[model samples]
Target: MRATSIGAVLSGALVLSASAVTAPAAYAAETGVVIQKVSVNGGKPIVLGTSQTESFTISVTASDDSGISSKLAFLQIKREVGDNYWSYHGTPTCTASSATTSTCKLTFKLDSGWGVPRNTLAGPWKVVVQLQSKDGDLYNNGGDITHPVLRRGKLSVDAGPEPVAKGKSLRVTGKLSRANWDKRTYAGYTNQPVKLQFRKAGTSTYTTVKTVNTNSTGNLSTTVTASADGYWRWSFAGTSTTSAVNAAGDYVDVR
Candidate 1:
């Protein structure tokens, strides 16, 4: 068959013909799976600080005129960062029972700990989703018979807290905002957890301060009362399990 962009025919209804003659049919060889919608339920862009759990839903519709051949189609998700990769299977958190024809749905919950690396640069992160046929040949003729897939959208990243003054009380705050795929703030501590640490400005020995949680508004603020008066620096560690992004903000003061 001819090669066509999977995203082109993802919407509306589709018809396909089933013939025993092999060697690849046409663009109509298999039923198309359309990703109807993707939503990050509570908040988008979740903030960078403390641990937070966020939920999401992905709606999809599939149909074929050649009859439903594969009933066990599955959805796959991944976070893209250069050559690094993190993948997860979409769980069926919700489903429609009365639906007929080749219909498949999947649900996914990505924790903040599953996000960008602590040293990640400020920019956009990507989440990719794909569908796979369970019991069918993936390759047909010259083209692959893989299920249709799409790059959902991007996640925004920002700096957290860093450079703290020694021997004085320092306040650190941060905000989480969405990007690319509809902005949202995560609910509860389900987002990534924020890690705080300090060290002498010129030294490398780092000490743990405190790891705090962000409020519903994706705001996280904490006071660091130091015991000594020396050049000091602080760092905010990021995780993928919660909604906290890897970031760092620095401050200095003389006491």
Candidate 2:
């Protein structure tokens, strides 16, 4: 049969192999198989950069009255409302914990430039698990779990005029950027909230001094009164589509 849509493409082209099984319309009610848990990237977001390939792990735990089959499992990470998808291309390593429960894990590698063609594709994505039990019960679902797939963020900080007198204004500058998969480079992440932090010369802690928003070009320039010897840096809390990042501290001395 010819595939027509994104779901169909997954169901037919990549998921219909000899070892793969598509859930029948009534598979849910007739089966005792239960997908107990699903974890992607160890419960953290899958972050990607422009040129380097990022590899992540997916794990599916399922149980049934009968033990799961020995066949390797299949997993698909796909966008909630788009054609973007990343699928496992190798065999999953399945380990049986008991007579009825098994956990299957697979690793998938994604090349940002080749795998992701659109920046809008960043955000929450769902996973589909396909497996069968020894007693013929099937478990294939896409709605039970979701994870964020994001672009890696980059931040730079510069705080200057060394040995400034106390109570004098110090100029702090920075820029926030993130991976652009389509352009295969890094670009500014404009209009995002970033926190300016300071750590005293002898302390191991950093406290927020102020919150500044990146301008049109993701550039940050702010002024603060020098109080003591400390390190200044910019910290981005990040958003749904971008990962959080902190710039290396720029030390300033106050005389």
Candidate 3:
């Protein structure tokens, strides 16, 4: 049988934006079918950078006494209640695990040019799924799943005074930034905590020296006493809307 896309089946679907709604777990309407599991991007947040498109797969595992239907499923990741979403326009491929259970999967692509809103927030978005059983039982959820989308972060660090007298003061400087989907550029990620780390020469591990917060322009700076030759770098733990980042180590010489 021909299958209808979830977006088509629920033309007036009213799932709210991630920022506005907290949806409950999806449950089948009848006892004939049960949705056992759902996974998006392998349960990892969808992260976007300046120019590359992200491709992810969604899988839905369901079971029914009457067996599952083949190639009759749809998946949608909605940014809002309306037409703004990443959808799998084709039929999902269903692989049966047992006579009564099957897992349906589909792939989707998200890029800057996909007609999605340029101002879409980098937090939780909703996942909507639809499926049918061979016995005619159907399952359609109203944004029952939540997934995160985040901006990719970048960090830079520079330790000044390449050669310094032992026990002298050394300076470290850096910047923290993240991808701005709307502008397609890297913009400063201000007022975030960043760790300044140091590794003694001949050592393979780095230890945190101090924590500094970025300024209004996402610039970071700090002072430390030079003890030994080593490398310096900055590390950001990341926030809900941004991905974690680390700057390359900058070498310093203490004479």
Candidate 4:
């Protein structure tokens, strides 16, 4: 059987993307999974502030030539740092928001008891959907089941204080966090540099005002004198082990 071996990893293990689906790929002819997007707290880049609990919704699409051996289908989250381990944290039962041979979608949450641990390590991690063989399926010449292709995924960020008073000091705060496969919680990314940016209400461009660093708890906080009403946010440049992220814009009123 001609198949690409993923090695001695667990039968629960599998290999790796974005845009709600992988951009596209070259082939091995084995039916595999595509991770459209893995949202942290319902956002990307998995940014949190001094928080341990979270919600994760993994949008997955999958297929297989052997009618999609549905029983072994599951989503796994893997962290790069620490144990660098991977596991299934989605749910015990398989319930698709939608399903077809060419597509399958599932959404689960951490608090719902379907996500990673409450104290999982935070950083860039892999969100995988495993499309494995079923009871009636046949192996390729007795070879190990193959994982055809895999791509990478993006991180997430969340910014706030929807409106700030003008001329008054605006307190901007957020968390630097990412997926932790071991514990399944989106944990803080402590002691990292994050740039604060602003855009006036009349302008479309944002300029960097100052840089703030995360504390021991991965909390980001800073104050900027209010001037013109516009938007404010934080941007993490990202290291080799993590992906870059820009927080959502918070509108401020300088009145």
Output the number of the TM-score-best candidate: 2
Select the stronger candidate by TM-score from 2 and 3: 2
TM-score for each predicted model, relative to the true structure: 0.31, 0.82, 0.78, 0.45
Tens-digit per-residue lDDT, 87-194, candidate 1: 545433334333333334454434844442232322232333333333342311221211212222112222222343445565555543322121332232324344
lDDT of each: 0.34, 0.72, 0.71, 0.48
Clashing pairs in 2: none
TM-score of 4: 0.45
Among all windows of ten consecutive residues in candidate 1, which has the lowest summed lDDT? 1-10
Could you tell me how far off, in angstroms, the CA of residue 197 lies in candidate 1 after the best superposition? 33
At residue 135, what lDDT does model 1 achieve?
Answer: 37
Q: Report the CA-based lDDT of candidate 2 relative to the real structure.
A: 0.72
TM-score of predicted model 2? 0.82
User: Worst 10-residue stretch by lDDT in candidate 3?
Assistant: 1-10
Model 3, position 212, has a per-residue lDDT of 99
Model 1 ranges off by over 4 Å: 1-49, 66-72, 91-103, 110-255
Top lDDT hit: 2
lDDT of 2 at 141: 77
Q: Tell me the tens digit of each residue's lDDT in model 2 across 113-185.
A: 3365468777766667888889876677744455677778888888877878999999999988888877988
Q: In candidate 2, how many Å is residue 204 off?
A: 2.3
* RMSD versus native structure for model 3: 10.2
